[model samples]
Target: MVPSPVEMFRDLPKKVCPECGEYIEEQAESYMMECDRCLANKEE
Candidate 1:
């Protein structure tokens, strides 16, 4: 059986970012997602 891209990366390690509540996949991604969320919130 082969796992799809999403399935393969589904359980890789993550954390619920306190600032954005996003399931972050990588350390870098967490920072990027946080900034994006902050920008989105500022716009709204």
Candidate 2:
């Protein structure tokens, strides 16, 4: 039997930002490697 979306999501590893040690939110379709705050700071 296939697992529900929530169950599948719960089983996935937590995504953390390597730059600032912050917990990154998961996106269904994203290529972001770092948290927004850090990324913004990096661009300055």
Candidate 3:
């Protein structure tokens, strides 16, 4: 049987911030390697 859309999403790997080790939520079509907080701190 084929997997449902929800199941496919659940199987996707979780995106984590390399600098802060926090889970990164996908906000757009582009991929993000770090969380917003870490990115801001890095810019300082």
Candidate 4:
């Protein structure tokens, strides 16, 4: 049986993006933060 990918990181601070109703971490890195539902420019 395949093992489920364990979530390695702790929960980040969440705030919904104005453009998309997706939770985003306050201090999100490129690898860590992204929207699952809609494509939007990641804040730099």
Candidate 5:
């Protein structure tokens, strides 16, 4: 079975924070999944 390039890249580890728009650390263990700025500016 041959794996596609996109699939291979998708399987790689991510290092971007979803919440604070900060860069995730290589050794970090957890993600917030929501950007702080986004949340703060969210429509109420």
Candidate 6:
């Protein structure tokens, strides 16, 4: 992981899922603030 992305992810106030309160991680620099499971559900 790059220092910047990690820093950015760490700084996000949008860490836990609003709907489910599950913990999540950053997938990309521009990824929506969603967990893997929630993101997949969103795509469906």
Whole-model Cα lDDT of every candidate shown, in order: 0.64, 0.91, 0.89, 0.51, 0.63, 0.72
Per residue, candidate 5 scores C-alpha lDDT tens digits across 1-44 of: 88999899679876565656676445446455645556566755
Order of models, best lDDT first:
2, 3, 6, 1, 5, 4
Name the candidate that leads on lDDT: 2
lDDT (10s digit) by residue, model 2, range 1-44: 99999999789888889999998987879888899999999999
TM-score of each: 0.28, 0.70, 0.67, 0.28, 0.31, 0.45
Model 3, runs deviating above 4 Å:
1-6
Error of 1 at 13 (Å): 2.3
* Model 4 weakest lDDT span, ten residues long: 4-13
> Alpha carbon lDDT of residue 21, candidate 2?
91
lDDT of 4 by residue, 1-44 (tens): 75444542334345675566678655535544446444435432
Best by TM-score: 2
Clashing pairs in 6: none
Model 5 global lDDT (CA atoms, 0 to 1): 0.63
What are the per-residue Cα lDDT tens digits for candidate 3 across 1-44? Answer: 99999999989998988887999888769677889999898899
* Deviation (Å) of 31 in candidate 3: 1.3
For model 6 the local lDDT of residue 7 reads 88
The alpha-carbon lDDT assigned to residue 14 of candidate 3 equals 88
Model 6: per-residue Cα lDDT at residue 2: 55
Give the per-residue Cα lDDT of candidate 4 at 36: 42
